[model samples]
Target: MSLKRSLNRALAATTGLQVRKAPRPSAPPPPPAAPVYHEPAAEDRLLRRPVFVISSIRSGSTLLRMMLDTHSRLRAPHELHISRLEVGYGSSVSEYAMQNLGLERGDLEHLLWDRVLHRELVRSGKDFIVEKTPGNVFCHERIRDSWPDARFLVLLRHPESIARSWHESDPAKRPYEKAVTDVLRHVEAVDRARETLDDACTVRYEDITADPGRELRRLCRFLGLDYEPGMVDYGRKGDPELKRGLGDWRANIRTGTVQPGRALPGSGEVHPALLPYCDSWGYTS
Candidate 1:
């Protein structure tokens, strides 16, 4: 008998059990990863090195937008929400035509976004443009692909404060619990951007509100623009008034003065759902 069979038979006869082979150890699961995107050829796009602000709702991005908008060389328009813009083929024949032309739905949408922003920059007579749409945090990589030379500013705020402000923005429609869930999406997205986008700049709402001029100077350095005094006193320059859908319309923003941000929420007061993000952003400690 084969030695293996003899051993198995002996074990079965002696102990009423066969020599059972151990199952192989499973390979460790791969680490969690984010999607990777590549930019299209240079000829495919119009805009270059445009700045985008990646932030959560109610993170004081509107206030920063107003400041940047006042810069002579830079234009910071209201929330463009351009990433949500999508393209669709009208028919299968059209889709086939586009496929043959080497254009996909995403590629077409990227072209549209680039052209739209380029038109805005041309109209404003500015050398550079900055867009501050909060939802862009979720699609930083896609934006990078669209404008291979895109710059980003990752805006952050205390997680609890963001959720509270969102709820209070429309209390009747957005209850506290729902607000936490909704805002958590943004908070997590911001964290992801911070973790992944090493080239992006990061600033806190509290820091911006605490010292407007200083923060504006820092931002100017990042954007490669001279710090214009007009950007510091944006209110006096007759900026576009705060429209409801475009950005913060609260009396504070309308007042055109940088107001101090609310105190950070105590650890005990933070929602459990937001704790992990809070920790990730260094808000808890």
Candidate 2:
């Protein structure tokens, strides 16, 4: 018999009907909690400062590196062969060595790769420091582990032309045969690495040579840099640091032949096995 009940009883008496309490309105559902969003901190957004290039020998990797070096934002180092040395073997090793290394190959590879990359990056001052090593194709994981935020530029060329060029060059003097085999092996390695890299790019040598401006623009876009026309003319500008051996193939090999043979000696035509890769990269048939 509280006041409210008394009032209700009074109301019931006056209205000739029983007074019943209204079921408590369901307490309005508690307001939904505000969504909390976490924005990445400044450190999180820093561009992964990789200055590394992985490409097969005779694949225009040198030219690509030189062109990239022309950019003020990048410093392309000469062929360091860091990965090759770390792997404890040269690319010229016979197939037997590959078998003998067996399970330990991966572990030894990881050790050598980690040491060289960490040392170089720790010592480098440039924002984008690149190691233009041909053997890196085989050591992408080691590179990726050391520099999780790193970027990779994989260069490719026609294997037939690569093999022919190697065969024609003095084997004893230049080790061209080994270079050819290495190029093929590295191509496959890069292809495998493509699957795991988050910020990786692939460029074809022919496409870069045929239309440097276009290719360079695309490359810059990939690297999140502003493209400059001067990158194409790096060689002509006499940049002393930029190596001159990039386009030597054009002068050294004859045109219209893919492989070395009696029919077409020294002619540097696109290799058939490599044609699909080149074509995929927008090379002319």
Candidate 3:
């Protein structure tokens, strides 16, 4: 999400409001359990079993990260675009092309990204590390390549809210198309990953803000951690270091509490073009 959009959300979200969504007649009871994780070999470094918080920008993934960071067993650090560095070799004439270079460049990228995660884990001395960067959702395979045991935590927010936040963040293009397209792409990316990985867990942004403890406790079990009381007190005990590193994305969480968030006002009707995404993802119109 853009800086302006981040600020707009910050200004508007003083307190969260539930939209009172209608009950899901077809929805199953107990919801779905997150993927079960088998213990890895003792030799496998805890750093290798990284956890990823994946979603599009402005979908509350950052807030989720901050909350998880407060956990004793977990550390949610700054964005490490590990996958972005793994530019697979392909035939192209562009300067960033990896085709001409042998496996050298790709190997280097893997090495650097791996080491970064390793260092972060070592510094925090935590059992696991969760990296949050919205764009990470698009590079599931790349992440898998580096750490076969890496786990994913996927988050979804209403497309209406996503599009509005995206457009508000960027002024150069000044239209909603790009925002809508990005949201759709992210939605598809997350769905594919859930289908492919047993270590993946999915959650909704609305659910998180609606009852943070419930959603987070579910996430905790998914990641195989015991829930700590006050895990949801992220708003009150925010991380200053994290806030500074986040740039404009820093505004709201700095409010020293998790402000109750609802669908953006007047966003009851999702845009027509974005309806396909809503239907597929279970977002009400």
Candidate 4:
């Protein structure tokens, strides 16, 4: 029939070669789209303008939380890990039912988080609530979506000190080398939140320990609250027991008074993995 087909048949006959069609390559499946979340209005959430402390592990957030809890109007709680709370549909019919009501999995989870925090605040009889979960830095965007009127407090510490403290917290379980890597991940997330959150107020562990009154005053101005003297003597109040799993469970925190932090690590003493972040955070000499 076709000239090329006839030539191929003649060549096949002469050389005993078989002609076979090559399989067509298939294009790869498209990547799954990222989930888009729309921010709910303030009235839809149980709590509005709640405060979140965004920080890396071993960054003195617990100390800050303890101080905030002493305030008359603020109630600071332990790490709730609300972002890890997820919702799932048990069946397709249930998923369709939820979809019909314009509720997604994230939306339901947001409502649950709001209710839990509101209950905590109501129980304490406090006007404002502060949540200081170190892991929340990773889900800061999700939190922003969940509470459009939320306020953020960015807490930073010397990256090298964070790595050392993390390793020292459990030397057997956390090797120094592994600690550096893990600490850096959190530091990067903090940087991202600081860059993106418009209402974020930043404070450093060093500043809080150096002159807590001054730092607390600055934070009060940002939070629109009056500085209470009790906040300075949080340890004397016997509130917010320093526990291991919830936060720093160390002798320094047990002292109650804001003790001066260990001297900043010298530039040469800083770990190689943490040097870049140290430079960015102004920890270098």
Candidate 5:
């Protein structure tokens, strides 16, 4: 073979050897840059204020829940009876017996309540969780200890209206004696809660119903939330879950009942029997 031909043969062999070698697997496309989620900061979570509605039964707490639930950021649960059973007494008898037995401190704070609430909110991806637990009025201190940043809304109705409504609903089930006892208990609870919680505010049912929009706006301002006009006519809304059981007291009351006409049953004031307790809370008659 000629020298030039030999050189050409050598070049061909080198090219063939290079072609036989395995190709470097294309650099595995840079493992997808770890997903960067712009999640809310811890400070943001701490800043969130959970609104708790505390009141006695038949005091239009449902109305307040309906109103607040209309806000896009708020999630008001039906009635999470957390306070009385979890943090304080189980019932009137239990409460009375505990007092008689000199039961002072309650059980340790349970995470079950918070876990359930957090789970529900997480599943729904809701920001605000409003718990409308009527029985919580007695456990304000426990609540404060649990959620220092929580905002409380106390719903007030005329004792007469509350008692009358209770009687009308199931007179056989709720006798006048029970109704009066509940009112008295509620008054005492409210008084104690007021003294303990400076962040608490009370809303009268009459004021709420008479001018719902105004009251809702005021409530939003108090809670540091933006008021939504939709909250005003929550009963008239399309969402059935939001609309149920609101303002139903109107239908339940009997004709010529002492409660139907006035904001409160007598003189638009707290009952004379409950006056001292109301005064303790700085509540005006």
Candidate 6:
């Protein structure tokens, strides 16, 4: 203690100041790192916006499907025929599943529908899927309920054109009256959905084919995709298995062309019942 005190006194004498220790200076902490944003994986994007086509039968939906599928990253194949299972008192799988396994309805629906979609997307090696089932116009509501982010395209052919096609093109399978009635119902649905859903859009057969360059480019814009040249020549690159499955619509596609679908002027005989819906959807001319 004596030696330490002597050393302290000597240092103080030499310095001519107090021997109190000086505090160390501190550096400011570095600024917090900025948050990083990452884009979703392709599979996740497909889940978010599974391309579901909804349109009346014989409305040129196949053409639209093929076009979209031609995009290097898009896969629009034949009718997956997504059924509406959410309706009916006895139809809901969830109630029974809940009673038995205590599984949530949302979980069950996702497993039944979204999981199948995910598996199919993985299988096809495509980043996205566009399911083209004309009959699916009826199931539009259910599809939206299932995947809230689903992108839907509704093809609108002239009602007279659709009615005539059904009568002349598909007479063997269903009655003309049934076709007309079904078209009317589907048209009503399309109109309603167009009004309600921002993601759901209507594509006129006339517009797309008339200006494939412009309309298709516009469509690509709507889809948040870059326009691809192959989209216009989808027939050349179309899937054979899918082509055969489209019933009579395959006849035109078989020609390996993407020409505008033309019916002989006056080929269509407009029924009175279809007038209201046809007029409303902008097909009067």
CA RMSD, predictions in order: 12.7, 25.0, 19.7, 8.8, 23.9, 25.9
| Most TM-score-accurate candidate | 4
- Give the alpha-carbon lDDT of every model: 0.85, 0.60, 0.71, 0.86, 0.63, 0.68
Off by over 4 Å in 3: 1-46, 86-104, 171-173, 235-250, 264-268
lDDT (0-100) at residue 204 of candidate 3? 90
Residue-wise C-alpha lDDT for candidate 2, range 1-285, written one tens digit per residue:
688788778878898666577898787788744222232233433334666776666666666766787787777756766655524345646435654644244445544554555455456555576777777777667666545666888776666656665555557755655665655676666667666664678776767767788988998998889997777666542344334443333432222112222222233465555555555544454
The candidate with the higher lDDT, 3 or 6, is 3
TM-score of each: 0.82, 0.55, 0.71, 0.85, 0.63, 0.71
Tens-digit lDDT track for model 5 on 1-285? Answer: 877677667877877422234678886666533211122324323324678877777787766776677688888766766543344446888767755644433422234455566766666567878888777787766666556577898777766677676667778887876776767877667666766776678788877767777888888988778888877655443343433343333432211111223544444544467666545544455
Residue 211 lDDT, candidate 1, scale 0-100: 88
Off by over 4 Å in 1: 1-38, 236-240
Candidate 2: misplaced stretches above 4 Å?
Answer: 1-48, 84-126, 171-182, 236-285
Better of 1 and 3 by lDDT: 1
Clashing pairs for predicted structure model 1, backbone only: none
lDDT of 4 by residue, 37-109 (tens): 4568667788968999999999999899989999999999878888877677799999889878777777778
lDDT winner: 4
Candidate 1 lDDT by residue in tens digits, 1-285: 888889999998989888777999999999744422245898887777899999999999999998888888888888888987777778999988977878777778888899989999999998888999898888888888788798999999889999999999999999999999999898888888888889988898988988888888888898888888777566732335667888887777876678778888874999999988887787773
Choose 2 or 5, whichever is better by TM-score: 5
Displacement of the residue 28 alpha carbon in candidate 4, Å: 19
Q: List candidate 5 stretches off by more than 4 Å.
A: 1-48, 84-109, 235-263, 267-272, 275-285
